[model samples]
Target: MKKILLGFIIMLSTLAYSQNELATSYAEKGRTLVMEKKYQEAVESFDKAIAINPKSALVFHHRGLAKANLKDDSGAILDYNVSIKLDDTDFEVFYNRGVSKYYLKDIESAIKDFDKSISLKSDFANSYLFRGYSYIELQKYSEAVKDLDKGLQLNPKSGSGYINRAIAHIMIGKNKEALDDADKSILYNPDDIRGYNIRGQAKAILEDYKSALEDFTEVINKKPDDAKAFFNRMAVRLNLEDKQGACSDYKMLKNLGEKPNSEMEEYCK
Candidate 1:
């Protein structure tokens, strides 16, 4: 009887080991698919892994990533919540959850998650960067500046970080700081037009009307249908006493189906 009982126990242990191995294989496949950007397929593979091993926190976290990439922020949050419940030790899980919450506009909740993530891993630059973004949404410019500064210090190549910090600086009336950050943003991401637009605004604030007009004109040169550039250039033209150019931009704004500002309409047309 003792021998038979031992054999049965060994059989059960072997079965459990095989099950775990299968689940791990599926989870690895899911991770590979995620890296391939085949998010839907990755989710399906994660589903199989989860069905086999519902206790795996990593699998749940990966599924949450797939869902987040799919733009299912609410669903991703649900998966992240499950992953956290399973094991709350992974800082990445909390950071990703915070990102999903940020996308959903749950700024306060996102900040809490980022705070937790930072507590777990203080050196993570993205946590500070995202926390800065959350603070910006709350219009806490000083707080945003502090967080963004830390993030940029940690990872200086982050173009989005520089641009966001520029916005905060502009809001705080630090036009020179804003201009410097905008320059950094352009240096990091020359293709992004927001940097040029922000630089133009900063120049206008600094009373460099010609330089500002050139920035706006550069944007229009790259993207002819950009109504934002046209509108800004129109204002700068007016500043430069080019009434005909301002009126021309006003017409282009109307052609693009953009609502010209009431004052601009009165001044130009």
Candidate 2:
């Protein structure tokens, strides 16, 4: 009986040690997978960590990120809620949860989360950026511009901020300001395809077909597989009465399995 009790204690000690080792290993692996953008795998690793240490708030937060990356916004929100319940001090959790809520179209809840995140960490540029985007979606252009300006002030190198701000400007009928912002965005990140796309859109709106065509051409060069770019270039060609060019772009769009609009059929045919 004594020998059995001793063996049982030894086994318990080994099991405890193994559990600790597994928690550490899983935590590390989860972090690595998150860095690699393999969010599903990261969630699995984080789940193992949480199983080993059920009280770990950080594990919940990590798993929340993985869920969010995989578009499981509801699951992500639940994880974030648990994490916040365990520990409300982590500002990043609120911010990330807000992003998930935004995608879920719970704008009010998302705004509240962003507000809480900003309250916890005032200088968070990304939090401000996302908040600004939410405001834009809610049709609050003035507020959107304010937060976007703050984000740009915090991180001037973020080309996306400029592009987003430009969109807000355009929505508010400040077309010239929008153009200026887009130009600056391109200056900040010359290779940003979105910047070119936005500039092309702005040029199209302005009826600058020549410049718009050039911008669309550049987009096609950057992304040959994009049917939208081909379709857009076709429109510009039609406007310019370049029938052959329009037909060629129309064929390309059709070959890429894109549904050409009636205008495309009328002009190209």
Candidate 3:
């Protein structure tokens, strides 16, 4: 009887271990899929993992990421809250939940989460960047610049930090500083089409139509199908009295069915 009981106990232990192993395997696969942008498949894998181990906080965190990628921010936040409940000290959970809250326009709650994340991981540059952006949205540009400066100190290679800092500068009428940061952003990421667009806007503000036109033309070259690029370039060309170029883009806009009104006729004429 003793030996029979011992054998049963070992069998149950092995089964339990097998279930945990399966759950971990599925969770890992789901995380990989999420990173690969195969978010729908990732959710399916996470569901299987959850079926095996419903109480896993890390699995919930990864599944939340997949849900957020699919634009299911509420679902993602629910999972993130569960994960935070299970492990409140997780910096990533706070940061990701903060992002979801920010998108949902819960700016105060998002700031609190970002604060938690930064408290947990002081060197988290991305958290600073996001927090700075939130501050900018709230019109606290000075505070935003402080956070962005810290982010730049922590991550010198971050082109987005430069771009956002440039925006803050522009908001405060620091045209020279804004121009410098915009140039740095382009230097860091030449292929970033938005960088050119923002730089062109800055040049336009400075009344440098020649340089503005060049920058906008580069943006259009990189992204031919971008409607904003065509629209912006047309405005700059109009300023320069480049009627031929402006009319050409108007025709392109017409072919794209972008303009519903007769404004193109008025502009081109």
Candidate 4:
């Protein structure tokens, strides 16, 4: 009877280990799918892993990432919540949860998660950058600037970071700093058109109409249907005494399916 009981216990232990090994295999397969950008497949593999090992916090976290990449931010948040409940120590889990929340427009909740992430790992640049974005959405420009400043210091080559910082500067009436950031944004992200638009805005605010007009024209040349660039160019032309060009833009607005604004009507007439 003693020998039989000992054999039973060993069998149970071997079965438990086997289950754990199977769960680990599934989890590894999910990670490989994620690296290949096969998010849907990764989620399926993670689902199997979770079924086999429901207590794994890391598996839940990885599943959350797959869901987020699928653009199912709500689903990602659900997974992240479970992961956090299981183990609240991983800084990356909080940061990714914040990102998912931010995408869902839960700005305040996202900031709290970002704060937690920063407290856990202070040197992570993306945490500050995303928190700055949330602050911008909340209209807290000063807080946005402070966060963006830290993020940029941590990663000076981040073009989107510079772009957002420029916007924050513009909101806070720092035109020169905004222009500098816009320039840096362009240098870093040359294929993007946003920097030209923002730079033109700064130049216009500084009353450098000619330079602003050139930037706006460049934008229009790249994106002919861009309403903001077209309108800006029209306004700048008027300031430059090019009445015909301004009137032409006013007429072209109709072709772009846009109604002329009050300013356009007043100036065009």
Candidate 5:
């Protein structure tokens, strides 16, 4: 009887080991599919892994990533919630869930998740960057500046971080600081139109109409159909006492399906 019991125990252990191996294989396949951008297929592979091992937090996390890539923010959040319940120690899971929440416009919840992620991994620059964006959306400019500044300190090459910081500075009426950040952003990514736009706005705020006009004109040269750039340039032109130039920009703005401001309407006519 003892020998028979030992044989049965060994058989059960072997079966469990095999099951775990199969689940791991499926999970690896899912990761490969995700890298290939085959998000739907990746989800199916993760599903098979989960079916074999429902306790696998890693599988659930991978499924959440696949869902996020497919733009299924709600579905991703669901899978991320399950993953977190299974294993709350992974900072990446919280960060990914925060991103999904951000896409869904659940800004407050996203900030909480980002806060948790930062708590788990204090050096995580992206968490700070995204949290700063959330603060900006909430119009907490000072808080946004603090987070963005920290993120940039961690990663000085981040153009998006500089751009966001510039925006926060602009909101607080610190146009000189905004101009500096915009210049840094443009230096990092010359093709980014927002950098030029922010710089122009900052210059305009400082009453540097000539430089502001040049910046706006540069934006128009890069993107000919940009109505906002035309409008900005028009305002600068009016400041420079160039009525003809302002009137031409006003016409272009209308052609781009954007209504001119009342001031522009009265002045241009």
Candidate 6:
């Protein structure tokens, strides 16, 4: 009887090890699918892994990532919650959860998650960026500036960070500071039209109509169908006393399916 019990115990141990190995294999395959952008397939693979090893935080985290890629932010949050419950030490999981919450428009909760992520990893620049964005959404421009400044300091080449910081500056009526950040954003990523748009807005606010017109025109040159660019250029032309050019731009904006505002209507008329 003792010999039989020993053999059975050995068999169970072997089976458990095999199951763990299988789970690990499935999890690895899920990660590969995620990398390929096959998010749905990756979730399926992760499902199989979870069935084999329900305790695996890594599998849950990868499944959350796959769900996030598919734009199922709530579902991703669920997986992230499970992963966090299993292992709260991973800064990545907290950051990703913050992103998922942001997509769900839960800005306050997202900020908390970002705060947790930053606390875990102080040098994580993206955490600061997202937290700053959440502050912007909350209309806390000063807080946004502080976080964005920290993020930019950590990653000077981040064009998105510069653009967002520029927006914060603009919100606070710091037009010159906004323009400087916009210039840095363009220097880092020339193809990003947002930089030009922000720069144009800043210049217009500063009463530099000619330079504003030039910046808006540059955006229009890159994106001809951009109604906002046309609208901005129209406003800049109005400031420059170019009534005809302003009317023409207003017409182009209308052609692009954007309704002219009341002021635009009066000006164009």
Each model's TM-score? Answer: 0.95, 0.79, 0.83, 0.94, 0.91, 0.94
For residues 140-232, what per-residue lDDT tens digits would candidate 5 score against the true structure?
999999999999999898899999999999999999999999999999988898999999999999999999999999999999999989989
Candidate 5 regions exceeding 4 Å error are 1-8, 260-266
- Cα lDDT tens digits for candidate 6, 1-269: 99999999999999999999999999999999999999999999999999999999989999999999999999999999999999999999999999999889999999999999999999999999999989999999999999999999999999999999999999999989999999999999999999999999999998998999989999999999998899889888877889999999988988899875788788777
Candidate 1 pairs with clashing backbones: none
Per-residue lDDT over 142-164 for candidate 1, one digit per residue giving the tens place of the 0 to 100 score? 99999999999999999999999
TM-score of 4: 0.94
Worst 10 residues of 6 by lDDT: 259-268
Q: Where does candidate 4 stray beyond 4 Å?
A: 262-269
lDDT of each: 0.95, 0.90, 0.89, 0.93, 0.95, 0.95
Per-residue alpha-carbon lDDT of candidate 4 for residues 74-96, written as tens digits (9 for 90 to 100): 99999999999999999999999
Q: List, residue by residue over 102-220, the lDDT tens digit for candidate 2.
A: 99999978999999999999999989999998998899999999999999999988888998998898888877778878888899988887677777777877889899899889989
Clashes of 4: 0
Query: How do these models rank on TM-score, best leading?
Result: 1, 6, 4, 5, 3, 2
**Model 5 TM:** 0.91
Q: What is the alpha-carbon RMSD of candidate 3 to the true structure?
A: 3.2
Give the true-structure RMSD of model 5. 2.0
Between prediction 2 and prediction 4, the one with superior TM-score is: 4
**Candidate 3, 1-269: lDDT as tens digits:** 99999999999999999999999999999989988999999999999999999898899999999999999999999999999988898999999999998899888888899999999999999899889888887888888899999998999887888888888988988877888888988999888877788888889888898899899889878988877878778888888999999888777776777854486687666
